[model samples]
Target: MSWEQIIFYLFAALAVIFAFLTVTRRNAVHAALCLIFCFFFIAGTFVVLNAELLAAVQVLVYAGGVVGLMLYVIMLVRGEDASQVKQALGQKIIAAFISVLLVIQIGSIVYLSFAGKATGRLAQEMARYGNTESIGTLLYTKYIFPFEVASVLLLAAMVGAIVLAKNKLER
Candidate 1:
């Protein structure tokens, strides 16, 4: 295979490995760290796919913002409380079954795309204006309302969280 393909496979494998580790780790901090590594590798895969904007967002929004927030929350929890949170055997079995199905679905999608079945309006737009431009055009034109609604919802949630936390602090 070519260098780009090799690098893409490397990143993909590492991303999968770290993602699995993230779920399987007993320690919360280690799981968070594994999740960050998985995000970084996913970003690398995006870079390899020539989606630089997506790569940057993956690193900044997920690896930097979300994982950092998760780490801080993990630290705030007492060790015993965190350790006591456990899944029953039946839950673990169901989760593993669901995970296997999800993996199979993803693998099929990747196979089909690589086998050249991926084509449509989005592909045309991507080829025309490129990744970032096409994404921006679609986001602003087609999905503007939903985008704005999500932003407003997020803002409301943040305000609610702050109010609740402040009330708890006052007690």
Candidate 2:
């Protein structure tokens, strides 16, 4: 196999391992750090795919910005609030069912998208202006609204975290 394929497989495996650690860790800070590494692996995949802009954004936005925000929120959480909350058996069963459904849904969607894809204009565009420039143009023009909305949503989450921290402190 090629070196690129080997690197891709390595990155994918590390990403999954990090993601599992992120979700399963008891400490919020540790989990957040694991998640940051997971994001780094995803960024590495973007680089392997020749989408340099996406890789940079993955590092900057997800690894740097979002993870920084998560660390800040985790720091704000009080010790008592950090205690593990035990889930009931029913809740665990429901969560497992939902997860299975989500996996099935995502698998079908991916299969359908691959099976139905016909056009290949993307290669032509990439040949002309390159991936980064094309992404920047499209993101600025067509996806501007969603970009703004995402920023607003993040702002709301930050505010909510602060509010929760404040409430915990007041009690």
Highest lDDT: which candidate? 1
Off by over 4 Å in 1: 79-81, 84-90, 101-130, 167-171
Please list the residue runs of candidate 2 whose C-alpha ends up more than 4 Å from where it truly belongs after superposition: 79-81, 112-127, 140-171
Tens digits of per-residue lDDT for model 1, 34-123: 999999999998877768789999999999999898888778764324655656889889988998999999999989778865223354
For residues 23-103, write the lDDT of model 2, one tens digit per residue. Answer: 778787888899999999988977677777888988999989988988886786653257477756797689879999999
Clash pairs, model 2 backbone: none
